[model samples]
Target: MHIRQSIIDTSSLEGQRISQLRAAVEKRERGTILASKYHTAPLKIAKAFPMGDALGVIVMDVSPGLLSGDRYELQWKIGHEAHLFLTNQSFTKVHPAPDSMGGSAIRQSFELGRNAIVESMPQPVMLYRDAVLESETVVRLEAGAVWMGAEVLCPGRTLRGERFAYRSYKNRLNVYDGEELIYAQRQVIVPEQQLLSAPGCLAELTHTGVFYAFSDRIKACHAECVRSTLEAIPNRSGHPIQWGVSLTYKHGLAVMAAGTAAWLIQEALAAVWRMLREEMLGLSPISF
Candidate 1:
């Protein structure tokens, strides 16, 4: 069930400069790339890596870095029976916006066909002092498709002694099964406007990460096994990040962790990802 798509653009966005990239995988003989395109500037796709039948590509930012008024639009399509692993070469950084009102924006869309699987794990996005950012992500999955993704947000450059100094941050993620919306996550942070360290807020935690492993085809036994595996994670007081995993919907499970160290959250998420990949894809863990 393919839907019509075009080269995406954010022309209505401020600054007007747009970079678009698209990629797809389809069957033909051994295989075929259904769609792959790029525009003004794009997150360059590097060499393909081997990971079973999945097409692995390393994502990167080719410019000095994102600046105010920069807009990046992306599309990813995994055709029927296709597999994709999306990773990044480096952590994403939203540089400080010189003009308070001029910030960067990223909008992306993803589609997965029947029996398709997509694993999207990228590094944290560090927000610098006075930085402003807006991001939205929309994903469409076929009934039998599977999707796993993880994201981490660092309050600021801890190494530079920066913490929650950013002006404003906003992100919205929406997931859909065909045309039916399934999950949504929305966040808006303004460090200057409110005390982020109060009791219910971050409580001085500098790093936060969330990971999801979902498929409409999950079985009762499989889900129970996953639940049992995730529940046994020891809550050691010395660990940098405290993490937990819980069943979300009938077909999905989510893990979220927060800590003062990035590597701790990274290690925790990587461990959970390994368990999920082995169970979901029957594949060995890929190095994080």
Candidate 2:
């Protein structure tokens, strides 16, 4: 149990500008999140970062949220017309804490403001057997700001058959609006090299999710009504679970979907908030 991770940055300032930032869980040799609920709304300047803001910062219901030669770094900075929303309360089971060496990793940094709006929905990450995880998300936007995000992965139980026996899973998402590296997504998972049966890997998918939405004034009829409800999702067993949407460079936009578990990508994110229910202001859609 080589656990040693601690990061803290609970930003809060208004009269002088540093709105709100949070990440606080000073230090814990093992993961623990029996229960946690975070809320922000009152002029919106959210804060929480030293392992706490992003909702429990990788919490495990009772034992393995992330601990196996652990090293987690989390940071968040906001100011330019700030507005932030991040969540977490369930579905973060990365078990192996007894003394597994190659199993936990996280590096997160997000800086926004210029009309800043950050929405993070965390709660769909469960990697058990031989689990090896890597996560890196870096974002810096400042040209009339706005950003939306998501990352979900599930494939251990596979209806009891156990697919992708795990052992390794890597995720990288980098977005920069200041010097133009708009968006990037990289993922790697290997189960005996078969590459999960090739063909876009995770072919016979059991669960996968990725979503990002950047903005510079997104109002094109509400993004085509959420891209026509994410292109009318339908296929399932016969292998109809890979979806896509793209629109970047200015009013940046991105949506990628893969389904099989997490209740079919949480019912396609609840039909994308019932097809953009007035652009989700009264936000309501968080389920494990």
Candidate 3:
């Protein structure tokens, strides 16, 4: 496994803290194993456990949370015929970023070899008042590879009566098959600058979630199945939940949802994840 050098220029960071993790997995006769791993301060992998034929990894953050001028970079490579399920240990808490610093950022890149599979389902992000965060994820897949990922965003520390108090939140995701870009999405949320409750926006929702599945094996029937699965989820009367599923440009599907609570969005995404696993990998539901 070849790990790429960091693209961040420390000299330009002006003493800002940088944390990084690089890991690769490969399929062996016994099963998939962690082929190589490296990490810096504040970032660690708890352990790798077996989940049927797949390997499960949980990333940990030792610091309280992200602070101003903090940057995190993660790279993951899965070899051919390997399956990896990735998750984080806790919510990504982004503390208030000073006006001068602007915000913290996280960058993640995943490379999948032929017939490789990766499922990344991290916890929701909690942005405190005046918090700003910029997140980017890039996925590169070879032929016969499949990738699935999910993310949920919280308005703030709702229990503390905070809602949409963050300075800014931006996320960009790109998926590529070999060298061809297949799907891309950019989401930017500036609560102070935009009317989030307006129609076509969040509209009375406090939390939002997104899920994506990409593979050459995906078909129209899978999209319909996702829609049906989402519709079957029961929603409470007063806590309104809205969601939609759509097929991507090619070889993928995307699901988006908004709700009053983070659990509402998380449960919905989990259901979709389970359904997709069954449909694509013929695997039974495995609880986390």
Report every candidate's CA lDDT: 0.75, 0.58, 0.90
Off by over 4 Å in 1: 1-11, 28-35, 219-239
* Per-residue lDDT over 1-288 for candidate 1, one digit per residue giving the tens place of the 0 to 100 score: 564374344546756556666777664445434455454565777556555567777778887666777777778888888888888888788888876457888887788888888889888888888888888888888878898888888888878888998888998877887777777879888888888888777775778888877688655555566556555666657654556667664466777888887777776777778777887778888885
Best by lDDT: 3
Q: Which ten residues in a row have the lowest lDDT in candidate 2?
A: 12-21
lDDT of 2 by residue, 1-288 (tens): 111123222222112212122332222233221222322221122333432222223322333466555545555655555555565556766655343355666666777756655667676887777677777778778877666777678877666676667678888877887768767778777676655665765565667776677766665566676668867767566555766666665566666677667767767755764444237443444433
TM-scores for candidates 1 onward, in order? 0.88, 0.33, 0.96
Ranking by TM-score: 3, 1, 2
lDDT tens digits, residues 176-238, model 3?
988899998998889988999898887788899999999998999999988889999996778
What C-alpha lDDT, on a 0 to 100 scale, does residue 232 get in candidate 3? 93
lDDT, candidate 3, equals: 0.90
